[model samples]
Target: MSRQHTSGDLRADRRYAYAEACLAEGDAAGAAEMAEQALDLAPRFAPAWLLLGRAREALHAAGGRETDLQGALRAYANALDLDPEDVLGSRLRLAQLGVGDALAAISPAYVRALFDGYAARFERHLVGELGYRGPTMLCASIDALAGAGRRFARVLDLGCGTGLMGATLEGRFDRLAGVDLSPAMLAKAEARGLYHRLVAGELTGFLAGEAAASADLVVAADVFIYLGDLRPALAAIARVLGPDGLAAFTVQSHDGAGIVIGPDGRYAHADAEVLAAADAAGLSLRSLTPAAIRRQNGLGVPGRIAVLSPGLA
Candidate 1:
């Protein structure tokens, strides 16, 4: 069931709407004032709190006011207290501001909402503007390691946004199945008729539901960034893979010891952490090659393409 807002009062809702409009119009002070008024009327209105937080953040950015930053933090904290499921993504905001420890994992609701809104322009912006070539890069890595004339019986595409990877591996696999969080993205993938099945759910959850040793190949192109800890997902992949099955994925890399949430709200994993996670999951690392996953802000984002197979006793 969807979460219900605390603001049952119609007047409070109207004030919140006006605050949102003011924020959109670049009037941060006005938005903050209106949001405060809305909150006064309906103290538990989480949306109003979120708006107030955003307005304070804007004010802080504009003038570097410590009080504004503190206000933003308090407002975000209040929203999280009212809605711990993080429907407003207060945790993400807090992490981005360096005010708290990064979340163990990004909220699935946030990822779904983000992709649902970005589905229409995802391909264009990612491929054209950001120079995203994750799918192509993963396929190239596969060809280099697996050699020519290689094929798989069944393939699972995790986080298969718009079937870009499916399109790349169209004839290479006998059966193709896709899993993603966003129905809108899945709809676009379905329109291409590239996958035999498409499931709208979290990656690990979908993998757990599949029959054991069912997939010969599992691929997650540019998807691991949303996942902070790789152990659970890798364990699920290990469980679902055939004896000779291979799991391939890309992850943004960091020089530190563990995963860290970047300012962009994406997680970057250290090489050590990834290797340790794979080893713990009883998977043998076949390859871990550095590559430029995509371009962000006109610069190449450093990442790794990893291939793992079932470990031998």
Candidate 2:
């Protein structure tokens, strides 16, 4: 049974219904064509345009024509241009295509959109399909971080996807909060009942909203991979921590960007760059260990987990 949405828009909606039907049947070319036709009638329908682009892209991936990439990029860009309210995630798909300078032009917005879109099935695809052990492995590692002041009064799990980290910290803390950009992900987290509250927001902005000197333990597992540069998020994390606070997070160790890193569009960071970012944030690294990278596309890559504290701590 194919899932369906109940939006009554008549022509455009019916076109979308047909396109979706074709898509569910695995006819990417037919779906793309129908979606393009719908978009022609409703040029402002950003989702339709974006879906057309995706269908075309999927077709391209399955031995479709080389020209499909360019067409998909154009359709996605057009959708984004029409409605910049984050209604469509063509930006990230554009970034993944690597046809042009789409990455730099849309990496941040694309990542945000990508995460939001995947928020619903984020864990299922990542953990069940890709064998993502980031949270499972990270939770195990956090046990070792319990040193002299391991007891946390207030804990914050940044990018607490589906509350996996919070589950690990469950009973270990009195007050807990989670923040991420996707409500669907938060919905899953909320279902876990581990976090006291889950907020829909990005890292930098959410960190800004948090009161200073509140969180004693802040952990972000597999969150930093989407980020190309780490200085901004690091600074944000430093700002929200107590003087003796601790933060544990993960990072990918590859050379470039635009997917193909860990098979989940993960962007690996360099040691020098991470060190420099930490230094710039005035946070000293207590320990950085090269942990087992999560499996992606049925393979594993190198990764690291680090515990950091305020310079004064």
Candidate 3:
């Protein structure tokens, strides 16, 4: 996912750069023109196609022109054809336009590339600018349900971005292991010296590789937003967790009957669907409490913190 991108022609690259700047400045028409010029020079350049799609999408959003929307979809589909792994997030863009599957919109390549680019200032921006407290709220829920003094022999942190959740439980666990998709974020977490083991992998795959009943606690703070379905992850968690062990996680919640992709591209799972997934996974819920996971635009984002144990439903 950490690969170089270029048009192979300086003029095309320049046009692409200018197109990016134009899009950032809200000049959709200029951006579209520049992106078209770039594509004309380098028809095989996927980034140019992606930029063209974004420019057209902005134009459609402003004017509600069906032609612009159709053009955007065609450009996105072309981008995806050029880069099947979707490192440029063409699938997400298509999903935003309601032209693709929402459940599979997010690609690991895209997430890895995104966090790799944002890793340097991720903590500062997320904690300082976004006012994110997902780790803190998740830890609080764990303590409330499992007891503050409960110490675990082994703990697993899923989507452990920069070791935030691991840092919160530093002294409570004898051994701490973390799994994340972004290598850059894993490097940051490694530098913190909190996790005894750090693996760069997807959450469910990591959990599947672990021994059954190996962990006493598993935590996923602000990670479920990327996953539209929870049944697979919950089933894997139940397999790895000991009978007495517990799993604590948080989800962006909505009032709908099922999961929905929010305008921000994050998945928001309804409370009933979450409970149903846990039940199907043979995990009994200890707590499902409303929480404010973070602040978006200076207002609290609605979420839910769930604590569960491997038990009869």
**Residue 167 C-alpha lDDT in model 2:** 79
Q: How are the candidates ranked when ordered by TM-score, highest leading?
A: 3, 1, 2
> Between the candidate structures 1 and 3, which one is better when assessed by TM-score?
3
> Which of the numbered candidates is closest to the native, going by highest TM-score?
3
Across 74-148, the per-residue lDDT of candidate 1 in tens digits comes to 999999888777766788888888877674547887788778888999999999999998988888878777885
What tens digits encode model 3's per-residue C-alpha lDDT throughout 1-313?
A: 1343987999999999999999999999999999999999999999899999999999999999999999999999999999999989899889877877888899988888888888999999999988888888887888898888689999999999899998888789999999999999999999999889999999999999999999999999989998988999999999999989999999999987788888888889999989999999999988999998788888888899999999876
Candidate number achieving the greatest lDDT relative to the actual structure: 3
Residue pairs clashing in model 1 are: none
lDDT of each: 0.89, 0.74, 0.91
The TM-scores, one per candidate, come to: 0.89, 0.78, 0.97
Model 3 regions more than 4 Å off = 1-4
Candidate 1's C-alpha runs over 4 A off are: 1-27, 62-64, 99-101
lDDT of 2 at 41: 73
Q: Give every collision pair in model 3.
A: none
